[model samples]
Target: MKVALTGAEGFLGWHTRVLLRALGWPDPVLIGRADLADAAVLADRLRGVDRVLHLAGVNRGEPAEVAAGNVAVAEALARGLRRCAQPPKTLVYANTVQAGNGTAYGDSKAAAAAILAGAAAGCHLVDHRLPHLYGEHGRPFYNSVTATFCRVLADGGEPELRDDRELRLVHVTDAAAALLDAPPAGPWDAAMPALRIGVHALADRLAGFAATYRGGDLPPLTDRHDVRLFNTYRSHLFPAGYPIPLVRRADHRGELVEAVRSHGAGQAFCSATRPGVTRGEHFHLAKVERFVVLRGRAEIRLRRVGGRGLVRFPVDGAEPVVVDMPTMWAHDITNTGDGDLLTLFWTNDLFDPARPDTYPEPVAAA
Candidate 1:
């Protein structure tokens, strides 16, 4: 289906794009700031699209600025829709649960939703009221408290609790799913389900992750929420926390090295690849995977899903090191030496065919 998106570069927008890529959908028509400011341009971009996910609005600024900015963007969108020769079949508005809660931001969001609804005469309008969202690559101090705490913990600092209120949190990917996977026939208004945690409790959980991860061990990821939180924490540690050198001990018989240290259950295995061959041209949504070169020279390349630029790492058995793959990154290992390459692989979960959680995308093309 042809889909168009506004605010396609924001944190949630980026995650939505990543989800679209994971679903094998064609790239959406990106309605950026310029297009949103021009009625004709926005209308032209929206033309012929099956769905238009309207996600543009201001949430942080002076009260008057915030209020005006939010309403203004929605007005522009409404004007654009009026100019469209054929309105989109579906219009998904990324509203918030806080909408109409008497705050400037909340009131503005409610007004914005009303504007879009008024403009969407014959469209299936899905007003998705998202909860507090947290996920990989969320901007610290701006997106959510989970992101701010994750950043603080990753930086070897303690999170200072300012408010201990409860948060009903939803991962941004799930929020994106709500927008993309809405029912075909709907003029419904709803909020996504959320995971609840108090501010202080959330800080403590992240603190535990920091303490466990600092020692090169995987924390206890006992559930899906835990896995998502761990992945969010790991996002702040990648490219710098990788290539952890294994402590090599030499005695009489042979050198003994502890490759992986885990605080939870997992699967460990190895692979042998011929020289000049490659393996693993895929990305995982929630799996924590590790690569260690036990007996050959190799290179591991990773590119962020739905993005450009490759992160490269060279490894050798002589000085084996741990390179853990970050979730949502397309990665691969290539035998660079003339000899056969032996590499150790470890994942926090046993392989399940029905829920593989793997998507194929070339690192070179990312």
Candidate 2:
């Protein structure tokens, strides 16, 4: 579908564009804030556009300015659409869940939704009210408390929580999907799926992740939400605070280091392999596994089933690295060091002989 999207550079806008592209939608005409002020420019951009996703608004400014800016932007877009030779069939307004509240931001959103509803008389208008959103690289302090906490913790600073209010946070990717999948022509709030947690609880969870990840251990990802949150937290640590060195304890007896620790982990094992020996020639369908070399150099090889080439990663005990095996990839590890190899393995669930997901296949065809 030919689409025109406003605020295409913003957080939600970026995610929405990604989703649209993934779904095979054509490149959307990006409308900037400046374009909204010029009816001629906007109308030209809207020409032949099948859908318009209105995602721009002033989130931070004087109360009166914030209120007026939102209403004005919507009015401008409507005026542009009126001038279109063939106006868009659908107009999606990205409103907030606070639209019903009496605050300036809420009132502004409500007014904008009303303006779009009246202007696009025949076209489908979706006044989607999104809740709190958090994801990778959200502006710290301005966009979300989650982002602020992630920034502070990543920088080795403490995030002070002044209020312990409850928050329902939807990941940006999920929010974008909801917008793309939204039904047409109703002044209805999209039931945005969110992960509800108290402010303090959320802060604590992120802090725990920061600690574990900084200590060179993969934190337990209990579910999809945990995985998303973990990724978001790590995004803030880029270009710095990365390649986190593990805490190594050495003695005359030998050295020891913890690789992975999780309250939710169901199984843990260690293996010893002689030089030139190889282990693992299989892939799992549902199981999650991580391999950490502890006492030798090795090369881990992986290839998707039916794929031609292998992806090789060389790991060494001197500097431990964890490689998480992905599902559907046939993989194996070989000891490349002169001495015997010691490796640690972990999985989220205990192995069941009856339902083991392992299927043996050479990473490289012999």
Candidate No. with top lDDT: 1
How well does candidate 1 score on lDDT at residue 286? Answer: 73
Which 10 consecutive positions of candidate 1 have the poorest summed lDDT? 182-191
Model 2, global lDDT? 0.78
- Model 2 clashing residue pairs (backbone): none
Candidate 1, position 352, lDDT: 80
Clashes of each: 0, 0
Tens digit per residue, CA lDDT, model 1, 1-366: 889998889988988888777777889999887987888988898989999998888889899999999999888888888888899998899999999999999999999999888885687778988889998988998888999999988888899988689999888877887899833222111234577999999999989988987867788989767888899998988888777777899998989778888888899999999999999999887788999899989999999987899999999999988899998899999999999999989999998876677888899992
Evaluated with TM-score, which candidate comes out highest?
1
TM-scores vs. true structure, each candidate? 0.95, 0.70
Off by over 4 Å in 2: 182-191, 246-366
Candidate RMSDs in Å, in order, are 3.2, 8.6
lDDT score, candidate 2, position 341: 98
